[model samples]
Target: MLGILVQLIISWLILRFIAKTSMDVLGYRINTTRLLLCVGLLLFTTMAALLAYALRWWFGERWGMNPSFSLLLLANGIWWNIKSVLFEELIFRGALFYLLIQWLGAKKALWLSAAAFGVYHWFSYEILGQPIPMLVIFLLTATAGLVYGYAYLKTATLYAPIAMHFAWNFTNNFLFSGGQIGKGIFVLLPTDTVQVGYIAFVLVQYLPLVLFFVGNYFLLKRFGKVYVGKQHQAPQL
Candidate 1:
């Protein structure tokens, strides 16, 4: 937690220095529209995740809800997830991405930021000794990063991606109990057993995330300016 706070502060300072402006210039401020968008995306992603879990359960995976709920535990989980994800977005999609846009064009910036975000997870996943293939994990995280980057690019606000990131993490970590980091408030399946094949498990788990990414990509392309044209200017709050 201390590390995350330190990283966030450093990221804020670096962004301010690089952009020659306040944090608002990096889309840190909030507004009604962005808030609404955030909420909508949150709900959408949560529903999508639940749907995936349901499909898995239907396919013979056993699931059971926790018998008791603790408000304190839920609050702590929310804080932890939000804090961790916020620090990441501020670094990968906030500071690094802003600089990349200036150096490369927007189109290049998008993929570059996404790739960096994916690569950033290599160390953590390695330390965790994730059973999934490294290449597969990299591709999955990179794809998620693309979705997040696209969200930031289109909305020009951290709210969209932050909400999406939080939802993804909260759903997987808290609601579904399938996350690599953090124990969930509820357990979706019996922790004692693995019911699905590893490859099938990965597909079922990540399909919604991939769908959300592809869906957002199209939405941004059709409705938002995702490409960095010559006339494009840096985003402002």
Candidate 2:
């Protein structure tokens, strides 16, 4: 936990510096709403986690434990998650996706960024759980990434995607027990425990997230700015 906290602070400072430097280089004005967005998203994440915990207790016969506000108050825990949101936003959203948008174009950048984000989780699956088939989960995660990326592109602020990420993670970790209908660290759901059928397990577990992405494709396309416009147009000859 302390380790996660330290890592998060380092990530936040690094990303903040990067944002400041990039803004100066590009002559792009700073978005003052960034901090507010972060706070709003963090709060939403907390609420969603609590909601999920309530649902699990009501329907799934899970422990009826109230969501821990203390966890959010815990210095390291809060820092770790906040860092998770900030660092992840900085790396995948701020840096990698931004460059990809400049080079490959926005649509391609969005999809490619999503794909890379999904693929990056391979290390977690392989190291943590012995190389399980995580492609399904990754795909869903990628789908979520698309929405997040779109949010960032639309708002030109880190808050939207940050909030969405925090909500999803908090729900998954605290309420869903890291299980959101896929092969994950948690098995809070009924179908998550099937030992023999891995494929069935994955499909049953993470299918909603997949559908969610598919349904949200339009929003992504809309906010993501699929067409290269004057704002991002090539230099005139």
TM-score of each: 0.82, 0.58
How much does each candidate deviate from the true structure in C-alpha RMSD?
4.1, 7.5
Query: Among these predicted structures, which one has the highest lDDT?
Result: 1
Q: Over the stretch 106-188, how does candidate 1's per-residue lDDT look in tens digits? A: 76888888788777888766734564666777888888888888787777777888887898788878776666644556666
What is the TM-score (0 to 1) of candidate 2? Answer: 0.58
Question: Please, what are the lDDT tens digits per residue for candidate 2 over residues 199-225?
Answer: 654554555454444433443344333
> Can you tell me which runs of candidate 1 are displaced by over 4 Å?
127-132, 180-182, 188-206, 222-237
Q: How much is 41 displaced in model 2, in angstroms?
A: 7.0
- Model 1, poorest ten-residue lDDT window? 228-237
Go through the candidates in order and give each one's C-alpha lDDT: 0.72, 0.53
In Å, residue 228's CA in model 1 sits off its true spot by: 5.2
